[model samples]
Target: MQEPQSGPDRRMFLRATAATGAALTLGGLSTQSASAVAPGGFPDYTYVRTLLTPSQLKYNPTGEIIFPTVRGVYDKLASPLGRYYLYYAPHDAPGGICLAYGNSLEGPFTEYPANPIVSNKWDSHYSVSHVSSPHVLWKEDVKEFWLYFHGENTTTRLARSKDGIHFTYDKVVLNTSMMPAGTTETSYARVFRHDLPERGASYVMLFMTNNTTDHRDIGWGWSADARTWTFAQTPLVRHSDVGAINVGGPHLLTRNGSAYVVYNKDKTSGGDIMITEVGKDFSLRKHLGVFYDSRSSAPENGRAAAPSFGTDGGVPYMIYEAGERLKGAIAVARG
Candidate 1:
């Protein structure tokens, strides 16, 4: 792990741009005007419907467990064919990468008949142990989908898929050995492929890692080809500043030229979805504040975390895990 660099030059550039009220651009995507902040202070997200629950999933009845206990749903990615792909892990069973599908973003998703698309046996390192927090990326240049996930919450791994359903294991991308000594583990990675000439790299990853104190924070890495990575030793988003003990499960969204990282900040009751602006170089910029909270009054819906963003018919949507870990349901929200 490399120590976080104090980016004075980059900060100066961003401050200058904001002072002049100039739109930022990256990879042809224009930034929003200074006046166009998130509507209603934060995104007015309304609950749509529940997408998945442990009882609702289609799993092998004769398998080790009758109904697999879900730890949490990781993320969702959309296909050009109008299907939404969701990744999750079963707590009791093999706990590998499982796949589910639905036609609508706010859907009654069906678990793939051939689920656990990528199992623990696929990787020789952490075979049959645990693999979770899968974030998939669609590489337009190669017309293939790449999956980034963690095994045993200690190593970040990669795999590739041709049709976004079946996947082939690639290699371990990040682990404790790659970080500074005393780094306990690394996991929950969110990757983005941007076209920012100033950054000198195209691929950026925001992930979570624990230090000797077992404190989790968001770290980052950059890659030119989306394969090999160079990780930052220090955290990109710290828990102290975010007002959360554990900050993980990062998701990236880019609009106009501005980029945002939507992640969960653990709270005593549950968790809240928070958003923060990210620099073109994938550095943490400004914290935009909480976007959603699942702890309701009437029909309480425990913790809500692990957010994944998508769109249907040009309408923005979000899918997240609601309830306690290992006993949660995947829910959807629309703007």
Candidate 2:
């Protein structure tokens, strides 16, 4: 995601890709045909309903929310937050890390009374202009939720919590200084626990990194404990590889020992989600075309970005940022 400016200019955020010489298109998996599965085993989802909009947030500081991701607690008895914790935040100024909770994946998620668990202003520790694009991972070994988000556009910070609500500020896991020379911004990160051969790392992170040329691509890193990370010399996926002007909001999808980066692109037709199979080694493989067709759905408004996937009661589901850039709502789909 591009850095949102203050006020009306915030819409300018992300003036915003695939492998294979030829992009592969999966046919018959229309959003309307929610029951069918795509050729490559992609879920053909039917848009259920708007899970959340900025307007629904009782204490929306910026009047907008972009990232919608959830993590299910194994032992609700031990977890104080709830059965499911939804994390989202505004991509605008004074952006904050907010929360909501529900008993089910298909939710009546109630916002936390004192929201912005991690506000932009933290005296003595640190303070920034804004912070948004939250991605949370529940580490089973440590029994803690690792929250990754960005502030000041160039830095991605980390925080940890046992209960999923109260967070202890960790350290900066990613920054532009760690990126390639031409890189300008790095944020909107999604981290996954995947083992890579020869790297001896237990986790991998994929994120949006912009260049001086204003091109956004998916950059990556490998981490041994989800705290410290080592960045790659190059990006995982480039805009040109997928015929997109820009791409961001990366989520990792693993199935049958294969890894795919699910991200959104900026195109003439409007932004839609696309997938690229980056195998276990994180090697750029094939472009699996339109993971979710935004053009066909009314909720999408010809745009869909930042997708997060999960399962509830043995059913697969996707929740994503839908509608225009910055001015969008969170929509849910199930197959």
Candidate 3:
């Protein structure tokens, strides 16, 4: 059977456009192009991050190998320790326990301290939900680092850090879900982080959200100031054709001059990657195609956090989620 495709239907797009006119005008995201795509915005898979097939790493009962489904990663300063911090619902000796890593994108990755970094004690946000989807970025201009994560129940949490690994714990930024009242309980969430590039005149916060229904879609809330965020009130991508079942990890990527969002879609547990691009102002976007699909091993399922991208020598790579039997192991794929 063919996998279900996801996108915004014409009627839904028309309705969303009419409802958020004022917000778009005020936020400056109204530069919608009816016919022009930003100079280079197309979502296509460059390459997938793969595992080294190290002897130290072995497969579990499912007989499928494991890897790091690095939901989020960022190089804060230059390189080395500050080079990359991979976060997920981490998988290791225990699995779905905490954040872990690989020194680089390809690994032989291990857990951090062999335990959960932040746990249920973080229950302040949502008593039942756990922390997932971490987006980390450093801002040299303000001399501060920011960690953006979402709890299972709450929309998202924003924290600042003087150093990359540790945070101030000062206060939760954007302490509320952007979901509409009637849809709050049935929704997935809104995950956002401002990926500020020092040279770029504008900043982009790649995010995912669901206004109503089961995982309606994922998108970003764009902002120039980084203080006031304008929810695309519309998702950057939609799974309208994906049968209202599953879609996750809509991490943003840019190539040349365009923007692309990557995600996984599975009616089952172990899922695969999906890519799509946005129009100049997100007024128009298209599902380029599926990069990877299907279960490699067994007991296949949907996916986990996001994937991290980097280059080895000169080849591009990615780290994502893979599951077999009882393990939702982080796995990699390459061109």
TM-score per model over all chains: 0.78, 0.87, 0.64
Q: How would you encode candidate 3's per-residue C-alpha lDDT over 1-335 as one tens digit per residue?
A: 22123322322343355455422222345553232111134322222333422223332212222323342234444443423455554222222223455565555566455444444344354342345555555555686756565554345556666645555543344433554443342112223333434323245565545445656466566555454555545555666744435565666666655666667665544456667766444555777655444333432244433455556455456665555322454555442
Q: Cα lDDT for residue 43, model 3? A: 23
Off by over 4 Å in 3: 1-83, 90-97, 122-129, 170-177, 185-201, 225-227, 241-244, 268-270, 298-305, 324-326
Candidate 2, residues 256-292, lDDT tens digits: the string is 8788888998786568788899887886668877777
lDDT of 3 at 334: 42
Model 1, poorest ten-residue lDDT window?
Answer: 64-73
Candidate 2 C-alpha RMSD relative to the actual structure: 9.1
Taking the tens digit of each residue's C-alpha lDDT, what string does model 1 give over 1-335?
22122222333454456578887663478775442224124344656777766665566322221111121212333333236666666544466667776677777677777877777676355574766677888877786788888777779888887777777778888888888898887887877877656656788887888988867888888888888888888777888878888887777777656777777887666777777787555654688766675555322154667777776778777777776655566677776
By lDDT: ranked, best first: 2, 1, 3
Output the better candidate (1/2) by lDDT.
2
lDDT values of the candidates?
0.67, 0.80, 0.47
What lDDT does candidate 3 reach at residue 126? 36
User: Which candidate has the highest lDDT of all?
Assistant: 2
